[model samples]
Target: MRLSNKLSHALSCAALTLAATPALADTVWLKNGDRLTGTIKVFDGGKLVVETSYGGTIPVDWKQVKTLESDRELMVKQDEFTGERAKSLKAAEDGKVTLINGEAPKTVELASIEQIIKPKPILEDLVWKGNVDVGLDYKRAETDTDDYDVDFKTTARHGAWRHNAEGGYNRESQDEVTTTNNWNAEYALDRFLDEHWFWQGRVSYTRDHIEDVSSQRTIGTGPGYQFWDDELGAFSLATLVNQNDYEYKDGGSDNFYSLGLKWDYNRYLVGKTFELFSNGELGKPIGGDSEYELDAEAGLRYKVTDWASLNMKAEKNIVSGAKDGEIDETRYSVGFGVGW
Candidate 1:
């Protein structure tokens, strides 16, 4: 009896190990009654890229796919014309996926599918993307002149939360006299409620000796909407209520409140080799001595490689209720930088 029990226990352990192992194959059924088993790499431009053991890599039109079965969870979205509905789903063997709603499993068709992306770990999902640009010039003459400018931006996303940080500095000197020197930094965090709606909080600080401003700081929060977000272009708008603090070069300090409206837009053209973008904020005071403020930038970028680009940009900045000779400033810069 002891030997028989040992054999049964060993068999049960073996069965549990087999059940816990991940499946090694993914299957796709075609409309023409043909089936293929392999690993799906990605889906883009209405094409599904798959790697098979027999065939190296196959590009199948999204329309030709009848059904797909996989053991991994993936993100699925519908076509653009259909409101771009999206969900996270896990597939079973019989070409069906169970949605998060706990409803009965539903069959999905290829025609309605826009994208299928594999799941990533929480830490792996925090991907940062942006660029930097710098410009410098120097002239050695009777009186020496030097100018330097730098701009940097980065954004990261994980799940429904996104974070962005940006900063820039510019300075020029002639004959040991500072002609222009200014710098600014901003940070923002956004929480997404859906594909097109988000809530954001922002903080910014600026110091500009050229404009006679020692420092200006702001904190704000608001809701935003993505009007268009696709390969061709994107646009977003938001309104925020902000508290602003100011310190002047002449030894004065003040605080105020404002209603701020902001706009961000970008476009990619010519096979995505060229990009144009603009963003701006306008603020009107609510109950303080401050009047109105504006900050804006527009830029164009030309891609030179996968990681580098050439850029030209113009910026405008203004603040109300500043000390004498401190109101507004503008500058233009051209440089090259890298991004992901």
Candidate 2:
């Protein structure tokens, strides 16, 4: 009885060991190299016991085992366009699957792919300079004039600041032989105070000659706030003070100071300015005009490349006192420029 009991205990332990082993699924590669589905029950020295979907166990030689498949699903959805499919068994080992030409197979570890789908760098950030533009203008007082202009401009940015220099010449010979010449130089510095609030300082000089009789020299400085900075574009608001010295062949020299608001919508666009100014000189006290002036301008800008662009502007000037006059001016220009 002791021998029989010892034998029974050994048999029970053997049965428990067999029950604890996991049942594996079989991946059957067809003769034509296609795949079929089944489960594997036992794999001994030289034979495999496979369980088919029809609920029968069949024994086959190990030499006939063309492929093996895990029961786990190993596919991942790649994109919204293409659909999903079973990753090849090789992909499961590598932890990643790649579908090429919608059919070829490639595999990579999941950790190796962490950087693949990340955001790409912006194209605008990579550019330093290039040029091109076309524009139109119209101005009316007692007489109306129409003008068309084309311009090219360029710019460059370095470490903490950028500098720009540009010049353009235009001609309008309808009623009078009027020609316009303009040159501009500007410098801007980007400053960071905290995270959300930052500051910018800009200095710009401009020389404009109109109709050989009127010319203006302007120098301006200002502080600006950047509200947005991203790959698409940037938006900022600035308060500026400008000094203008005007020389007219008929009129005397006039000096003016302007306080204005400026906005830059994008790398290639700018808009909206409202200016209030005071002329420093007094003509006559009793019957003379007041020295205060108001000016407003709106314009559009386009960047052809990092270093070139075109601009169109319309401005209205209103003055007070004897020197008070209303002037409507429209100008279009393309410029080639460089900066750093």
Candidate 3:
């Protein structure tokens, strides 16, 4: 009879332990007024172990805890660009709508929140696009010059493969039409090596022409490095060597060298960019002494909708010796495009 009584007592204790386990998994309010909801794995020696549902173990201090409760939900925030979600606990007891998947605790003003609902993480593929532009320009020097240009660009990306193609045509007053074309293709295999460093390689080609003045062509390939990666922004550096051919007026042929930096700044109001150029040149002039050129440009892009945008760019030409001096080129156009 004593043996049976002992077995019954042991079974009763096991049942009570199971029932109390979930109760200990309740919400914990810290002395600093922070709130957390998870299964408490340890609560001894003024410390605690919380097994969060998002699959992580957190250790916290008992002194930092104010009051422990059992009926509140944990909230978090998310990144708008990367669609990455992160969780954080509440810091104080206030009537505020909390983001359940954000990086930090956010006090969503009652007036700002149109509605309070469960937030879900956004999962979507990267977007790809294609565009075209047609415009007219008036050019006059010692002679009357009138020109019209039609440009088209197409871009496609799937996984690591990306391709860009551009072509343009310009007609001069002398009934001479010049055609220009350029293309770039790159394959990016991104490796998340501890979240901070990456390496990439790209190949590109360019061909440009101007009636009788000059015609230029180039082909290059190189590797690049990325140092920072976050929602705020990132920086990268690359070096490339191109085989360039320049044919000038008066039947003169010369070769030029190309080298420059590619900077990406997506932090402030400016959107996105791509710049490739050479400032220093080693080429003979047709009639004058050899000259140097400084070529740079800034472009602004505004997205009016998912299918359209406006692009405006200003280019500068600062040459050591040239007729009519340096000139600024401005182009503005509204275009409609589609992407996947």
Candidate 4:
């Protein structure tokens, strides 16, 4: 009888512990006398985005949060401080935070915290996210006309390494005459050397009918610097040594060396509903008679839903080495895109 009673007590205690686990989930306490219990996705743009069981996702202003507690590890960032991977952070009295990162217990004021990111689980740690946009049109007035455009982007991050790729194609035909035909693709890989320094390698291929070029290929690698990385914007600059190869329409080919500079920036506004981005690349020949080349784009995107957006973009491609009549090409387009 005694043995049976002991076994029954042990099983009862186990059941109660399992049932109480979820009740002790992460929590956020607001200064306005509100308490939210859910998973905090990230803190950015002065707001905290949380995923809840009953309310989906909610954005709460950071200033309104008085305390936070989580059982999972988080990537924490502060002004001028590198990101710290921490776990078991809990709120204490007097607007303080407590966590064990590596050393002994550490405490900090709530206001000094800039951002907190949930650690990605193994299944989603390296998931890719990006967008694709396509535009098409046809006309049958006096003459048949067809136009098509496609743009693609994708990126993934793992540990200190990041990878990005983008490409696009455009075509226009009027009465069986090809008015425009162009396509370009690029891929870049980056490894963060430190908080503000990184190394990158990139390769690109282009074919421009207007420039009288059958194909252009470039391969480059160099160091880069991150000037700023925050909720409002991120700006980066890089310089590289490029090997350029160009094939002309008249069965001519040229290979040369060039120095390339790249600039990329992004901005978000209106609670992440509106976004503006621009990236440009410039290549100046170092030897073998290759003129300067410039490729750039500026775009504004408005989110219509979680996965859908309306995008307006302007692009320019210039090759000073091109034939006299085909030196510059500019385009503007609007389209719908899906993002993951």
- Per-residue lDDT tens digits for candidate 2, residues 96-133, read 43433336655544333211111114422122432344
Candidate 1 TM-score over all chains jointly: 0.68
**Model 1 lDDT tens row, 15-42:** 9999999567777777688888888755
- Model 4's number of clashes is 0
| Per-residue lDDT over 1-340 for candidate 3, one digit per residue giving the tens place of the 0 to 100 score | 9999999999999999898775435566655656787764433223455667754546565446554432233222121123222143333343333443444545453223211112233323232344554445565665554555455555442223334454544444543433322222222233222233334333333233432324455544445455542222334454444444555544765555555343333221322222221111122233433264443334444545434545544434233443323222333433333221
User: In model 3, which range of ten residues has the least summed lDDT?
Assistant: 272-281
lDDT of 4 by residue, 78-157 (tens): 64334566877888765677876767768878788866766566623343567898777789999999988899887776
TM-score of 2: 0.40
Q: Name the regions of candidate 1 deviating beyond 4 angstroms.
A: 1-107, 110-127, 231-233, 320-325
- TM-score, per-candidate, Cα-based: 0.68, 0.40, 0.40, 0.75
lDDT of 4 at 276: 90
Global local distance difference test of model 1: 0.74
Ranking by TM-score: 4, 1, 2, 3
Which candidate leads the pack in TM-score?
Answer: 4
Report per-prediction Cα RMSD to one decimal. Answer: 9.9, 24.2, 16.8, 6.6
- Looking at candidate 1, the ten consecutive residues that score lowest on lDDT are 79-88
Off by over 4 Å in 2: 1-131, 135-148, 152-155, 164-168, 179-213, 267-326, 331-340
